[model samples]
Target: MDTVETLGKYEIKRTLGRGAMGVVYEGWDPSIQRHVAIKTVPLTDVDDPETQEQIARFRREAQAAGRLTHENIVPVYDYGETANVAYIVMEYVEGPTLDSLMKNQERFGLPEILRIMKDLLAGLEFSHERGVVHRDIKPANLMLTSNDRAKSRVKIADFGIARIESSSMTQAGTMIGTPTYMSPEQFMAETVDSRTDIYSSGVLLYQLLTGERPYEGGLSAIMHKVLHTEPLWPSQLSVTSPPALDAVVKKAMAKRPNERFATAAAFSEALIAAASASAAVVSPPPEDATIIESRRPVAGPVAQPVSVPVATPPKRSMTPILAGVVVVLLAGAGGAFFLLRPSADVPRPTPSPTVTTPAPIPAPAPAPVAKPEPVPPATVAPVPVVPRNEAVAPAAKPAVSPAMISDMFAQITATQRCAFIGGSVGNNSEAVLTGIAGPGARDDIRQTIASHAVPGTMQWNVANADTVFCPALTLLQSIAPPFGSADPVLALTLADNRTTLHDGDHIRPRLTMPNFVGYLRVDYIAHDGTVQHLYPQVADSSGAVADKVHEFVPGQKVSLGDPSAGQPGWEVAPPFGTDMIIAVASSRPLFTRPRSTNVETAATYLRDLDAAVHAVRDGGGTLVGNALLVDALAK
Candidate 1:
């Protein structure tokens, strides 16, 4: 493992590079006498539980890239795993990476840029058609070289994290891609297809033209811009570009996948066309010219010009010449038909018929009017209407004040009120609810208002908490057991609201729970069906639990892998799937016993345990504020 002279049948010359996951070495295949690059993981990680998971993904990358065959894609020859290391052999591409090229300030010409992009897209098209998505498509992953004739050659490298359609390698809520070049869908943690690559390619094209990224800043800023901002045009970035190029960039980088080009092939065709059109219109066009044609016939013979000059002393009227010239011009042109056409061409008016005078007649007598029937009066009743969240006005006037409404909410069971936000009925009967926890929370509050307040007056705006709060709420519901009340609502806020975790990454969530919680427990469900109790072990006999309840922490921050729990903080492990975190709170001690097993091979506690912990159980008076362990965990 220490700078070996050879790996299998290949002779290692020197190390190419090293990344967090593995190492790349420049080697030679003795069998075919061809230069090959060997990629392998460190011998030390083959034993670590977390590293084993990454090695599996590393092998998956080999499988995904090995199945692909393209001129522009890096070719994989062989892959194998030893007792202590995993290695992949591929063709050694000769040239600097696109990242290196960009750093050298090597600006590419329009034609060269087009060619490189077309080849890159062609490779992506091949992979996508085969149901493989190269999630990470950035300058660092692209290899570039210029031939002796100045023609650029591009090869896409490092399909180490590519997603295969049939693989199921990644989880549903988990995101995997570089943030800078990621698509809007990737940022939203949505399932992606080939269009994601198209978005990244658009970013690359913009960078190629202007020598800068379209969106630049921190991860949050980039995400906000990607989701809600439109990038500047190439022409606006000081690049002398044509309108067609701007159109291509705008369409290719559209936030929605459907709005972008459907396939990489389509993206390539548009890119080629835009680049060519820009090249053709580099020069200015010529000015306009005018010509006048004379329609007079030359039938008359030439007249003698003798003494006519002597008669110039007599003034000539120029108005007649002008009128004659106008007439001649109109005749020669199409206007002559309207000015000199015969009467047959014009529409003729029809003649009216003659009328005879009528004879005198006698007048008739007027008729008498009948009496109207008497109408009966009837009584009408008003319909009682309730104000819901639908923006409709309530028929009945709201009787409760803002303080009264808040008090009524306080009376509801904490479970029922988990998703409720404090709301008030205005003097105009409009109800505005703030601090709504999630999207579903709006409906809960609306139902509560309809039951207790005037109908058609409640309006809850969830826009403020939606972006960050909804995702965690949805995640909690998806993984935890069903609960009765929304109370004991647990809001887990990640240090940056980032859900994506990697090897050696720590996840320290700031948790917000109800004030009545006396005891809390946290657990983790990994992708491999193993459940890890992340906090509050049942074996801890210390009085720390009682002390924690005595002190009410509004926003308690703790790492997932707290050393006190005898485990590393929320470090990412292998078999990458949608890993979940569960938290339970109760007024009394949990009845079930906690299990401690190997960190990597622990069996799931909820798998077949028919106890109260597996599902929500009514704790009766034992549970505080009507929320049981399941209700608390549901947060």
Candidate 2:
């Protein structure tokens, strides 16, 4: 076989790499005047079934990768086939593969490892939600755009064996994918799903953390270990690895898909929580001090008292002059008691003492006044009087005025249509901004808010929106609830792990309350601005309850919209755009009774929810919330 000069309009410059199936070339796109990587598979004897299947798979790769558009994914620009070869042009990245870097003994710090994992998981999450599973998720398939740890960016490649939900190119009994990174189900030649990629990602994460694979050896040996044995914990293998991450790895690589994290987002959240826990351990706060874990600095005046030790003065003998002075002070104190005594006609003002004394010397009594009213000695002697001229100081001023914050939010809303920005004052005297905005708008929004607010007094709970047209997300942001900075007590995920669904598609919401033991209320905000209560159906006599974990009993995980469980799922409809699913977990029931209407305007429902959340907070009950956004596309 001879190397060709060009494939379609792409002019081949040099061979980049070659594999058993095809060769990748560094090509130039004449029209775009940019470099592109052209991957070509040679076509021989098209009538042969093996050749025909290979060509089908080659085209499938193009279709699968073409459907995805994400920053972390290598996008396919075009796909074409000549008489003797088929090629796909992709965005050319200039860096080594993760496998090559690992082989070269690249040492990745915890932060770098986390960054890589986040990018990988984000790309996987997006692909999984769209019903595409990259059957081969190995270090070899992950490309980096830079060698510098801080600047390196991960892009997933090689979708030749990817299985799209709507495609039946791969059969269940077929064994495909790299052996070392294959999931247990994949090795067993069983039907694979998103969890399959999760298992492979777990392998990659393990390698990144411990500098070794969980199972290493020949095909049969690796299979046996993956099927029946547990690997050493990452913390054991790597001294710097946090022990908390061990459980995350175990869950991700569980033999059964049911035991794994349901979605990539869930897995990422768990990893972040573990990382945070590790960070807290490394830098513990001072004793007798309140620790407020917040995403932003708390604004306002803070009083930090400093203690100073004073030396005792040298002993001195008392003289006749000192004795005379003591007598004078005793006479003055007696006169003050009479003048400061409360009268029956006037109410007594509360005393505010400035200093505390361990003991007091007895003073000489003055001559008795004429018809003196008897007063309690305990009250008169201990209470210190404040001057009538001095008034109590007013509370500290906020970092930024409320009007200024409102004006900033208005400006942000005007420029960023997909953004929903809201502001409030926190208990710690900081100005808190909570909402969702697209990636492109986040920097501008942050800068705008920073200009009007104080540096240390501003906190944020604003999450970056994955898509630009998220109306339901904007609604959730507008109704921003005060969620604490601690790990979320509850989680809400779509059953399919999808953020988008086509019209007529059934939507299922899954709620997990790992540590929460209380009442649960789930609500659905449709694209059309209507809200519906999914849990605690109007006919049900009892409210939804999430039981806590006891000995041998796991925490609650409820799945809605399952017909086998006798629950109906919400179906996608017209007025397609973004929708939201919200789950509120509380120690007590949010509402006293079920909702009367089947569906109501989002404004009405959100108002009721706000009242319920307030009531729960006022009652001293625990409250936490989680929400997911879904895009309803027209089929």
lDDT of 1 by residue, 1-635 (tens): 54588888889998999888878999999899999999998557466887877887788879989999898899899997776678999989877788887898665655666777888999999999999999889999988654331555788988877888987766456667888899988877778888999999999988876666776534543554576556547654322344478889889899889999999999999877776665433222112111111111101100100011000011112111100000000000000000111223222222112111112123122110101112221111222322221222222333434443333332221122223223334564453433224335545544544443322344433222222222222222222211222333334333333344543344433333334434445554443444544444322343221111122232222222222212223344344433444454444444444444323232334432223321332232112111001101110
Candidate 2 colliding pairs, count: 2
What is the per-residue lDDT of model 2 for residues 1-635, given as tens digits with 9 covering 90 to 100?
23678788888999999988788999999997999999988888888998888888889999999999998899999999888889999999998899998998676666778889999999999999999999999999999987665798999998999999988778698988888899988877888999999999999998987777776544543554466556666764444466688999989999899999899999999998887787322321122211111111111100100111111111111110100000000000000000111124322222212111112223222211011113221110111112211122222222333443333343333334444434454454454554444555555645544432322344445545444224433323222222222333344445444456676665655444535456666666664556666554453333222122111111344444432212223466666665555656666777887677556777777767766755665455655555555567778
By TM-score, the best candidate is 1
Query: What's model 1's overall lDDT?
Result: 0.49
Candidate 1's C-alpha runs over 4 A off are 43-49, 145-149, 279-635
Q: List ranges where model 2 is wrong by over 4 Å.
A: 1-3, 279-635
C-alpha TM-scores of all predictions: 0.45, 0.45
